[model samples]
Target: RNNQRHSNNDARRPPKTFMPTNGASRTSRKELLDLIGNNPGGHLDESSRFKFETKLRAYANTPNVDPSDVLFAIGSSVYGTNISFPVQEQTNGSKPSDEEEKETNIIIDFDYMKAFMKDVFLSYGVKPVHAETCSEVLIEADRRGIDSHGFGRLKPIYCDRMDQGILWPDKPIDVIKQTDTTALVDGNLGLGLYIGPHCMQMAIDKAKKHGVGFVVVQNSTHYGIAGYYATMATDAGCIGLSGTNARPSIAPTFGVEPMLGTNPLCFGIPSDDDFPFVIDCATSVNQRGKIERYAREGKDTPRGAVIDSDGIERTDTEGILKDMVMGKCALTPLGGAGDAMAGYKGENISLIRIELFIAISLGRGLNCVRTKCISVHHFKSDDEMRSKKKKSSWDIVK
Candidate 1:
């Protein structure tokens, strides 16, 4: 029965389109705009429309793909259905040959995906609330078009870590210190998926009492996305700031050894516009997870983004991954390979992120260490900083 359903859908799928060899040019903008039509639900205004077009041009320039095809995929994403985009099909970690065009993906409904994930976590001894929290965070990533951190990491990162005893499934998150506007927490080596939301909520609650709140957490595993916590603050009518320090994978300027993490910093600000102002990004030129994704699709990592042990640029996806694990390769700083590009600025930002949590926690006499910080600043109705009378919320992070 399932096989029959798959065959039916495959027959209805649109034929793949041909990709342009060169990047999209200015002359192609009008054609691309015609293909996408007006923004659905007015989700994007003129400024955003211009930005989206710029992004499409960049994607078109990516090796072996057409800009129009990528734009079609974007359209499909917006409408919540397949819209005949010429996206390259991916199965497992391998790309199939041209003869495999008939192959179709098994589409699972969103609710089903969430339920399955919740069940999987429950079976691993996770508390019901914690399991649901983790499931929702992962699903939100997919809903917002961030497949890299979504269900893709459910098994490999979260479940496997739980099985190996690296992440405590139902562990209690403990508070080591607290004040009217500040807090220090310990995650008990639990999943950050659960800990992150809990702490962010605590910060929001504190902001309600005072004008601003700051919370620092320690000993947590990978959180789904930094933007999630920031979004939480914006939803509560407050400005949000969040960042985390991870295992070192990025090298500082003028240094060959990996010394700093790809520490991500995120901000969410309330606005009168259709969408709130949100910015999220890592301090490095590119995240290691992206390299893994490219490797999965049998594509090479972009040039100048990675360096081997001898400080030479490397592009082989598989080799880079191996070398990164062995501490023989490191991601470049945000500006690129050297000081001339101001890569040192990214290095400084990462160090500041680490210091924020460390210095603040130590001042409070908290011994917990492993940096993750969430801070919120609430506003009153008559606050001078309010942008306008309108209220809307949105999130953006890379």
Candidate 2:
């Protein structure tokens, strides 16, 4: 939902070269076989499998290779790595042609890919732990085939946000409130990527004791993936739920200007295995990423994603931007434009998100007051009550 990073870079650029080849290119049976054979474990871990795949697609559009030929070539090489062929005998009982033999060849080097991504994140001023987690999340998404939220976003997120003060390096998250099953976190203008995970951990601990725990936070920047926070609870044997309010970019049904954010909700339920049913998605039918995707594939937007200056549905990219920035055209909710298409449901969810944001803000205020209170007359009777109460050391806002 947060496309603030890459979507604006075209206005000032070094005219970078083409993107790298993606794994989606027609992968040969041979390559799959080689990868399978060489990596007998089958790229199954969170970091090795999913994250690696996510990084691959990002490479496809980077400034090193032709996007068109990369996938195809990689696919052919894949076929060479793992395919089986039936040999034919000539009158002389000859061997198969090189083309047939090529179907069983192998040609990828994974270490280089890892190094490439590492260099990229480090260059963006990401703290080592943060960069590692970011890379893992992206590649894991790719491996799981969720290309929509993978490494394709890494460069913009770390580098661009650092420039904007949206992502800070090594800033400690300030905790403003804490209780048994609930707390409020002030990110202190730090990266939500780090603060979010920390907050979720607090919730997980509380849930272990109270059956359910929830934490609402504010002033946190965009966390890369919502699933990352929700899954933390499920991983610890409890159902996990996490949601965040983002900068406004989505329009409520029937409204032209953006008022509600593309607020995301994520739920994680643990199953028998490691692959839990974790759903991470935005409230909007289509997000800023989807818009950029249309521009990337040279395709038109689907109906209902955006409206023009005249309040009519439109697919033109420039027009979409005009409506987004100047024309007051905004993104619709999960349902289509009107009540007939379930637009009301989207509005209902928006209200829920708004309530969560408000609850967190209010809760923080209450906690701040509690920090400044004392036992008063119980401690020193009437004499202590007459003295002016000292201000709380942690109450920065007051």
Candidate 3:
């Protein structure tokens, strides 16, 4: 029976997930759990099996996940679940208590993490310089506090895609057309990490010469984070702006199926501060990456962030991700689910750019298949500063 099979191979599962950062490779997990919980072992029961498998799959999917991240990610699932590991080791021994152990974070050095990721890319036959460039972009997400798009994406977004033949890490970038201030490029299914920088640098170079530049890329896959490209322009002392289109996940205001990607937009303005003033966000209220992070944490997606096939708000992160990719569910737009808060505005903002890019690119020469958008918003002159302790200067006009 299925029940008997579930009981057979799952007994060692819990203990086998010992945190690697604890230097515990020499100390097997079974021994630790035995010491802590009287060597308890049994197959996962049907009810708890669902929870256990969910957490286990997430753990297996993200192998290189940092121990610090896993502390919160699988910590609660491990300690509180009824499947196994019933007791926590005490502070009586030289070993630290569960509380202290949870706080013990083995942080990865930034350079080391970058070097490791570069090696991962290189292993896939990426050119050394291109691999390094991709690594830098992925690491910058962590540096900028965008955990959703950081190294967590490596296996699923890059390595797995490469494995499945969805991404070509070694393809050359082709410039389809070029003008003094504009360009159309084809990534040839290349790594977005390489294509993104190459395109942004071209834009930056043109900006230096002409005060503005426009570059559109097609056939690229996920490009790490949008902020990385926008910041590149800031580093060059020019206002940097960029966006990327991704696989569709967002639905229209009243529609049920997905018709738009998360459609992130990011820009960086040089400022007097230590870092440039940068704004980066997906047009959807909850982007797919954030949902993936939640799934990794064994947590539910935020309510109203996603909608299922029945037109109901869905909170199951894993299910929503699966359904969205399959067109059975869709993400709510930036404002929320309905027109009550103008969610359609967000839906339009994310979708129209893709059409515009494709049309423009195809009209010129090659087809535009990339997923990002960029546009300017202008504001009229307004009142000057007012005291923070009092009403604003604009209040007088009102």
Candidate 4:
């Protein structure tokens, strides 16, 4: 009887399906939609959607299990039952495949990641305050799902440059010129991730006192994300605007060689709703970072987003990265390659963003094009204005 009972238990044991795999898992559109509960209203925006898909694919590929199978296992475990799955046999003591090795990733806590980044910056002589600020900004990008601008950028964009002595850490931001409501700053070639918040804060302060503020920074490195500075003003009950010109990578409409940065224009406005109104994007059809992301994932950029030297649209992700840096490829404008899509309009917008700071300073009769800029505007609400008027009139009569 005891032998028979043991046999029955063995017969009912669930088979293991989990196995190490060689390649990164790819995600289907169907799986993505399902993860979001198939709710149209819950669909992610373009950038967020790409990030979500990328992360999902990375996770799915990490264990080399079919996404559905993973889901099935979870469901079965939740319902207190074991599901059987066929297991692949592997040779004893076999080394992990190259693809599997490449797919492996270490999962770290958010705080630990920030601490590590902080140490990296500190080791390079960044000021304690600046190091914390920079680390927070990068981590915030990851938290907000903007992976392209987040922690992933620390090495390539900031630290590596610092190590090469190309990026100066702990440099003072000098005020080259200033008025009650406007100023010109020189970043001393320091990390813009640190300089950006400082300049925006100066603008916000001036706006509170003078109703508007305009601050510009010259000789600055790439600021992490333009929207971050813009939202700073909105947080302070003011309208915020920010933009920057990068090393040129965009070609004007009907032309092939690069002449414009994938210049971004960002705006933030206070609202009565739960979230502030914010608009932030590159004037190009797609930002270059997205292409880098596609290349990292071994995927092609969407069709028509870039053109090679031959003036032909290209989708070769890795090739495009090489070509663009060598000036053999160019990003399209917001409307895309040609006039049928009104690409010229996007070209016009790009020019506007670059010219905005120059024009504003020029209109104020200052010939200072050396600095990139940000602006802030504050206004009194109608009710407050009415109340102030009533009080002023009463005081005048008295």
C-alpha RMSD of each candidate structure in angstroms = 17.3, 15.6, 14.8, 17.6
Worst 10 residues of 2 by lDDT: 373-382
The CA lDDT at 385 in model 2 is 16
Which candidate, 1 or 3, has the higher TM-score? Answer: 3
Assess every candidate by TM-score.
0.67, 0.61, 0.70, 0.67
Which ranges of candidate 2 are over 4 A from the true structure? 1-118, 321-323, 354-398
Off by over 4 Å in 1: 1-106, 360-368, 377-398
Ranking by TM-score: 3, 1, 4, 2
The runs of at least 3 residues in candidate 4 whose Cα sits more than 4 Å from the true structure, single-residue gaps closed, are 1-107, 359-371, 375-398
Runs in model 3 deviating more than 4 A are: 1-102, 361-368, 373-398
Per-residue accuracy of model 3 over 288-336 as CA lDDT, tens digit each: 7788878766799989888877899998888888887778988899788
Evaluated against the true structure, the overall lDDT of model 1 is: 0.67
Q: Quick one: best TM-score, which candidate?
A: 3
Report the alpha-carbon TM-score of model 1 versus the true structure: 0.67
**Stretch of 10 with least lDDT, candidate 4:** 378-387
Tens-place lDDT per residue, model 1, 42-117, is 2124555465655555555556554234343443333222233355657675667655643433344456667767
Model 4 C-alpha lDDT per residue in residues 185-292, reported as the tens digit of each score = 778788888888889899999999999998877667877777787788888998998877666688888888887767677888999998789887888988777786
